[model samples]
Target: LSPADHLVVVRPNYATNIETPKAIGCAISYVDLDFDQGFAIDIEHVKAELRPNTKLISVTCPHNPTGTMMTRADLDALIALAEHHKCRLLVDETYRDLSYGERLPAAASLSPSAISVCSLSKAFGIPGIRIGWLLTRDPQLQETFLAAKEQIGICGSVIDEAIARATLERRDAFLASLLPEMARRRDIVQAWIDGETLVDWVRPQGGVVGFPRLNIDAGFDLDRFYTRLLEEHGAYVGPGHWFEMPKRFFRLGFGWPTEAELRGGLAAISAALRS
Candidate 1:
């Protein structure tokens, strides 16, 4: 979508989702996910914000940072709203394979106006390949998007394509092995968060990360706290400032580390917090 296009963003969205549109100066409309309700998106609230000039309604699930999944019914409602409003639905399905829940139909399959973008990075565990693909029934938009892509010279190298192809060929094998471990890691994270007196979070349904907020007394600098966690205890986690959320929040990556390492990291964070 262009700068003049009005795009609706689902929050606490991935920063890229929010920033990219703003960088283009799009007339950004936000429908903040009700964070208190496990980050649920309200379809009626989204419809209430729609404008005649709206061009796209963008969303992500299994969502970034929060790792929440949207129900199929919710997706259907969103697609219907997009259709009625004459706007395209843009879905970032980067973590779709990692999500644990009832399956939602590919938005592209459900409607021609929907576009789904996916990459091997999250689920396929081939982020280094730096390759991703898009699906769209709207061939005209597909062509236009490709033209923009072509202008950027962003074509994947041959090796990247080969890796992506092989990964897709063996997708089930990779997922079967990876998913259980991810679930286990998430459990560890949940337990760790539960143990924290001054930290709590919206537990992620599936996917690797959780964004927990530090319930600090007034005068706490989360930026400094994170720095001290790194410098003093060797604990490293992403702060919410990076994602444009309130400074009290921090991201925990449960899926990326080995279980023992993650345990050690969490303990280190606990120690740092206590200090």
Candidate 2:
């Protein structure tokens, strides 16, 4: 990889904390998705970002924070563009299993130029497992990724892999049990948001996170609001600045704790908002 190789990334992405293009020696480009339009990526905008040095395109299905999914047509267009440009397309499908509608075909399954990465972290509630996989039909690319991995962590711990394998083996039953709980929690969060007068958001179509914008007309101090919420109400939600968004928006996670905890947290947040 070289700095001259431009790797385009979608923002409000889940894997931002982990896989960064700059870390891999690639220049970065970004395609801004329209939040008002369900956060759909504009294909034309993406094409406009492309330059002669562009070498890769990356996207997250069931996007982080907003939980918005890319349409099948949009994904196909991205894959086609990658093929036309002779660049790699990497699709991160960490939340694909939690999606509402028919899941799009894995990019790796579509073309040798595409790569797919998935993990047991988000949907499976197993971040501690630290097990994730990259899929590609191209043996050369696979070998190259493996070589890179060898220079890093080499391989996952045996125990972690065993647990991950077990989780995969019982995935159907596990998902069956978990889906209802996630759905229920999502509803609760939605209801709470609906009841709020000072907040607005596009309902998430899938996944565990939602981004809501605060109705602050004239420079309401988010730092003050967040600090007060944390100190007085003991409520914790991620600040929007972390996602490169306007300070009025904040990321809420509905998947981390039990229903009781989630409710309590929401109540505290609501109280903070009212105050």
In angstroms, the error of model 1 at 121 is 1.0
Clashing pairs in 2: none
What's the count of clashing pairs in each model shown?
A: 0, 0
* C-alpha lDDT (0 to 100) for residue 219 of candidate 2: 66
- TM-scores of the models, in the given order? 0.94, 0.94
- Name the lDDT value of residue 134 in candidate 1: 88
Estimate candidate 1's alpha-carbon lDDT, on a 0 to 1 scale.
Answer: 0.83
**Local error of candidate 1 at 236, Å?**
1.3
